[model samples]
Target: MKCRDGQMIPKEQRCDGIVNCADGFDETVAACAELRCQSEQFQCEYGGCVDGQAQCNGTIECIDGSDEKVELCGRRILVRPTTEPPTTAVPRCELPKQPLNGSYSVVSETNTTQTDYVLSYTCDPGFKLVGHSTVLCIEGTWPDKMPRCVQTCQLMKHPSIVYECTEEETEKPRQCNVEEIDGTIVKTSCRKPNYYSPVELPYMHCQQGMWSSGPVCTAECGTLPPESTPLVLRGSTAKFGEVPWHVGIYLKNPKSKKHMQICGGSLISNTIVLSAAHCFWNENTQRLEDVTNYAVAVGKLYRKWYHPDDEPFAQKSDISEIVVPKLYRGVELYYKNDIAIVIASRPFEYKLYVVPVCLDFNEEFSNIQLHNGNRGKAAGFGLTTGMRGSESPVLRVINLPYENYESCLNLTSPALSRYITYDDKICAGSLDGEALCRGDSGGGLAFPSSISGQRRFYLRGIASTSPPTNDQTVCNTHALTSFTSVIKFEKFIKAYWYP
Candidate 1:
């Protein structure tokens, strides 16, 4: 049936093709008309769709318009084509972020492509950026973003002083301060004491009015403890105190009963003993082998002749060689080069009662001459009292002054005066009275220092001689002694140490 608009809605029937009217009448006549439809239509029977056969059933040609005139069916109409446009996708972007405080840079990314961006950080005037200055964008987001630059810290105050003040120019990589002292202005280089390749600005201020000076400058290695002390073999048993004495022996003619005098000696090494060169320099009768006649004793606080205990401190060894400088003039006790070396035939094995002292080479000689000079200890079995006295049983310990060389030379022969020089020799005791006496020649003088956390002593000088005095006066007064300075002979000792 046709609607009020005259548009026919086809009836729900099994038709081979689309029909123009509701009844199957449009399809039956269209099949008989034998008209072919286009590719747009659905193929069906009884729809004027002749298809490939192009044969009409036994009916009038209504689809060909022949049915419109003959069968009186409505004419076929064409459907119109509608026109509309395609839709487009929307565009989007991710938000950018800021770095944290003290930060200089931040990063951002686009969501669609995930592209990264990095930015640098900057601070305002009077402020500083102290943290990481840059960051990278990752996963559509920036890591370490929103950085804030902060203010710089105030510089540390300089020490107060009236002297010209220097400015600190450079700062350490990890540190931010400079050193200042009050006093006179001391101009110091930018070099840091303990750091290598230290950075600098230019100048630093000394707070005080005066500049610092002297040997006070420290080494690059920093402050070190005191020098090693000379080791004493029997140091443990002996009471701790000062003993300034020396050992000596008598020289007698083997053929004639006549007696001659020479300086005695002391042991300071395993195979070395110290003495004066003048004692053996020109003396034709004396030989290095004569060392067997001498001995060393410790423990006796005072001089005593013929003490029974002297043997305990006494150790005797043969002298292998006598080393004296070739320039040495035998006539005078060459005060400066007055020292000699005695090589023992065998090394002295230390026992609990005997010890050796360390020698100080770099020590200050002037210091040893001042307050600490008379403050030394001496050990030997020299005569306790009187000429021609017997040996003491206990080691004779005495306290002696380290005297000036000028005064010591006055006591000796006039010819010997010029031989003594401060560089090689040191003087001790009274020229006209008792001093390092007759039997104390060739002994070691020691100075001690606390080094390596232990009590130690250093062999400082060697006993050389009894200052030359009139034979009658020498007997009337106690003998004054002199020694060769070990500090001066440091090179000489180390040279022949092995040989």
Candidate 2:
């Protein structure tokens, strides 16, 4: 080896506790400390090596006291043999396997006699971790189970749509793909009352660890009947598509077991119809009639309940439920809150002649001035003329001008006028003799309004009652007919409207 002074010396003279170089560089502690020991030797902390058998022998062998240090001898027992190298027993751990659809990296590692490892886990873009993100390996084994990557679903964002997860307890929106478990059911609905999902009863379902997308909400409603011409004349026959929302309510007679058109109703939704509560009242039993005994026929032009020609275009549904306001007291309140919603056994399919009419939501047309000169239309298969007149064989519509609250009160009979109130009733009829009669008790009185740049008919009133005349006529055409205001009972209607 060469000394610091550029003098050459025999390698055996280096670190031999000798001052061979004149400058003493060969015996310097810093220079000798850089030299490493062979596998069979024990190294001193500051300078030189010694025989392996002298290590941890309960005595200080190396001059720097390194061979007998507590840290080195505490966890290891170095077996000494002159013929063989020293041996040590150590604990070691191997690398753990990566999870599926995920990856891991070593955060820290040790290669000494006692080995240890730490790993951090990460999932792919569309996956989520199912366990701890970090893990420790000790004594040749992982301390915790390996994390797994699971498939997750993302929820849709829309202004009119609301989403709810069955598994979540909090109301806050979930972070993307977090806590979205497989087989979870997410319910979807419209945020607004008038808005609805294009898909009925829309929902999202998770399958195979993935979430399916749900339906979007829309406010497209009250579409006019296709190919139907609007008529301005009063007391005229309704076209096939003109009164598509009109429905004939039928009741089965106990003795005859035959269905007959007893009242009229209007389709407000695919599964709901707006009618008068009295339509379902059984006078003999003094209670509401059985739902199974009632049926509704939609998109019918014929007045007859069993018309052969109307079968192809009209759809019939069995009655499931009939809901009336709890505040209603039948005739004691003088037909106050007479409105009722009839739920169909199943949803009706929208067709050219079978569509729902818009309900008077938010009192959009509550102002009487809007209908001052513009007449509202009412359609029914009731009597065409006097009280005793035979029921019309075809559907008919009558256009009538609306009367103010005070004027309607004056025109009503004194016996019934006391019970009439502005909040519960509306007056509409023509003195020239066009009016709804006996069978029109539950029919809808709809007025056309422009909504979203389109003309749509909205139901404003439900045909309720008319005062009896002096001649004992059941339906007097000259009398102003009283209808239950739809807007006044909006809460009750909406409560039962959806599902």
Largest TM-score belongs to which candidate? 2
Which ranges of candidate 2 are over 4 A from the true structure?
A: 1-213, 217-220, 283-285, 368-371
For candidate 1, write residues 1-499 as lDDT tens digits: 4422255654442233333543233443312235456675333322344233222233322232222232332443332212221264223323444432333433322121112344567665535554445533333444443455543333333221111243344332223323332321233332222112223323333333222331112111111123312324321122322332233433545575433334455445556656777666544543333544433332233333234554565444445577777666554334347667767666654433334445556766436543424545555544444355644443445455566665566655675455556677666655334455555566666654554544455566777655444554333234446567787777888876531
Candidates' lDDT values, in order?
Answer: 0.44, 0.73
By lDDT, the best candidate is 2
How would you encode candidate 2's per-residue C-alpha lDDT over 337-435 as one tens digit per residue? 888899989877666677678775665346732355557778888876665667888888887778877888777778878556777888888666767
Give one clash count per candidate, in the order shown.
65, 0
Q: Distance from true position, residue 462, model 1, in Å?
A: 1.5
lDDT of 2: 0.73
The TM-scores, one per candidate, come to 0.41, 0.58
The predictions' CA RMSDs to the true structure, in order, are: 30.7, 19.2
- Model 1 is weakest, by summed lDDT over 10 consecutive residues, at 215-224
